[model samples]
Target: MPKDQVLGPDAIAARLADLPGWREADGWIIRTYRTHSWKGTLMVINAVGHLAEAAWHHPDLTASYAWVEVRLTTHSAKGLTEKDFALAKKIEDVVGWQPGLEGGALEGTPSDPRFAYIKHDR
Candidate 1:
């Protein structure tokens, strides 16, 4: 594909093959990063925002106590573009992400059954 051009379905699929946790969804490429705590989740979100701003390509982000879902699309191009993929790659790098690293569905499960976990001193 040409530099910074909007990618079609085939090209998007090919590019997505290399992006482990990302998937095509409703005209955007999306991924959810799971963290062990709210603090970790916020850390990831803020890092993404910084990277997006630095790259001049922002993504839609949704955050919860332990997870943040990122949806990337080029609003100017009206579809996916190389910029989105580039930003995703940068975010993945700084976040130290691995596919399913948070253990999938069992992720964020508290060690204590009471769900009243305490933070440890740093």
Candidate 2:
């Protein structure tokens, strides 16, 4: 597929396979990140906001006290495109990172439920 081509359902489905927890709906690829508290919810929203700005591809987000719903599409292209998929991947990586699991110097959020932020999918 061309770099900027608007993707059809089949192409979108194929691309979505590489991105778990994301799905197509009404011409947009969407995902909901579940957080444990209002603070976590705000953190997700802000993280996504920074990522979108950096990529220059914005995504619609709906939030509650415990969850954030992210909707991505190429508005200028009038459909799902590479931009959407790219941004989705970035969002997933930043929002779902677990440093402790990566065997790095940085320890992730504590194991105690009280310290847990995002409800990571298992």
Candidate 3:
């Protein structure tokens, strides 16, 4: 679908509810995962790579030693769309991980020292 004809917030939210671990940001959907190490981070990237190729949609990705950030937006469409949301949902499902119950805890909160050293790229 053309990005110009992308879905609105209401449509995006309806679909997003079905996709766990995704949150809205600047009219786009984003999800981040914390891995044990660089190897685990690459594993997540590889998984997302396959998904993006299969869908013919790409996402903005940032990776560190223990974290991978994925931001989905349809640059061609100039905003969010069903395609972006679909990809975000697929990533969340296939990654086999979810954010912590508390906001930003899994990403690394003071209480959880396990992932405290990891840094995410925006």
Candidate 4:
């Protein structure tokens, strides 16, 4: 329950089950998001930055022309903790959300390849 408590392997694995593309690697929970181009990659990074800043729990992100890998670990705890999992869940929810599929006013970006952004996983 405490933020400083380190999670064991089992706890990490259990938490990762709810996160589709996230995994427990070494001492962090990580996920790599595939983007359509450099622009999409920057968008993902910026979104993650805002979330991390708001939560006050930053993550290490590796970005490329087409992908961004998010790695979260609780620095204060020196290992995986609730902070890592919480931020990871928030990142996943925000990054993977598709308002268009919900059929609301926001019809999301065009599905066409010419205007597509992040390649949402099925």
Candidate 5:
């Protein structure tokens, strides 16, 4: 498929199903990654940036101390496209995501100290 080809709802829906937290909004595929600390948030942002650069399909990212909201759309297509969904999946992989899982768990934990702050009572 062409890099910037726009995708319809059926295709989009089918792709989004396996993507878990990502959703369609304002002509973009969006997902907010939650983190345990500011450091964790930056880590996620950096990982996303690296993936986007590697894929050559960048997304708009809004990063705060505790989260990053990623918005993907193919500006050249002026709408949602395969590039957007394609990158979203890769972001999911790099972020250590498990589909259908929520943000309560520490995703990258011991490897990433920022995610190591919490202790379980049990």
Candidate 6:
């Protein structure tokens, strides 16, 4: 759906149910993952790069030696929208994490805590 189609809380909640390890704050959807090392972290970033390119929707990301933080926001919409949720879902799908899996989910807090903010015509 188009980003302009603003979604209410209920709709957003429903969509989020399908995606775990993600949460909404302010006007963005955020997720964080842990990698094995710097190399693994880059792998995740590169993987996400392809997904973002394919979707034409990019996320705000930060990386460390073994951690990556991804935050999604619909710049065109000026607030949360289906696009953000869609991108978040794609991230989860593409870079899947299985509990107890070797690469498992990222642990610890995010290094950066900021969302990509796009100015809108008000």
Best by lDDT: 2
Q: Write the per-residue lDDT of candidate 1 for residues 1-122, one digit (tens) a residue.
A: 66567888899899899888889987799988877678777878888989998988889999889788899998988889888888888887767643234577645535563442222221
Model 5 TM-score on a 0 to 1 scale: 0.79
Q: How good is model 6 by TM-score?
A: 0.74
Error of 3 at 35 (Å): 0.8
Clashing pairs in 3: 3-77
Q: Which tens-of-lDDT digit does each residue in 46-100 have in candidate 5? A: 8998999998888999977777889999999999988888889888876855422
Displacement of the residue 22 alpha carbon in candidate 5, Å? 0.3
Higher-scoring candidate on TM-score, 2 or 3 = 2
Best by TM-score: 4
Q: Which digits, one per residue and each the tens of the lDDT, describe model 6 over residues 25-96?
A: 887788777765676678779988999999999899998887788988888877788888888888886677
- Compared with the true structure, the alpha-carbon lDDT of candidate 6 equals 0.73
Estimate the overall C-alpha local distance difference test score of candidate 3. 0.77
TM per candidate comes to 0.76, 0.95, 0.72, 0.96, 0.79, 0.74
State the C-alpha lDDT per candidate.
0.78, 0.93, 0.77, 0.92, 0.79, 0.73
Q: How many residue pairs clash in each candidate?
A: 0, 0, 1, 0, 0, 1
Worst 10 residues of 6 by lDDT: 113-122
Model 4 C-alpha lDDT versus the unseen true structure: 0.92
Candidate 3: count the clashes: 1
RMSD of each: 7.6, 1.0, 7.3, 0.9, 5.9, 10.4
Candidate 4 stretches with Cα past 4 Å from truth are none
| TM-score (C-alpha) between model 4 and the true structure | 0.96
Q: Give one digit per residue, the lDDT tens place, for model 4 in 73-106.
A: 9888889999999999999889998989999999
Q: What's the C-alpha lDDT at position 12 in model 6?
A: 81
lDDT of 1 at 53: 88
Q: Positional deviation of 67 in candidate 5, in angstroms? A: 0.6
Writing each residue's lDDT as its tens digit, candidate 3 over 13-120 gives 888888767888897788888777787788889999999999999998998888898999888878888788778877876676445433674652343546443333
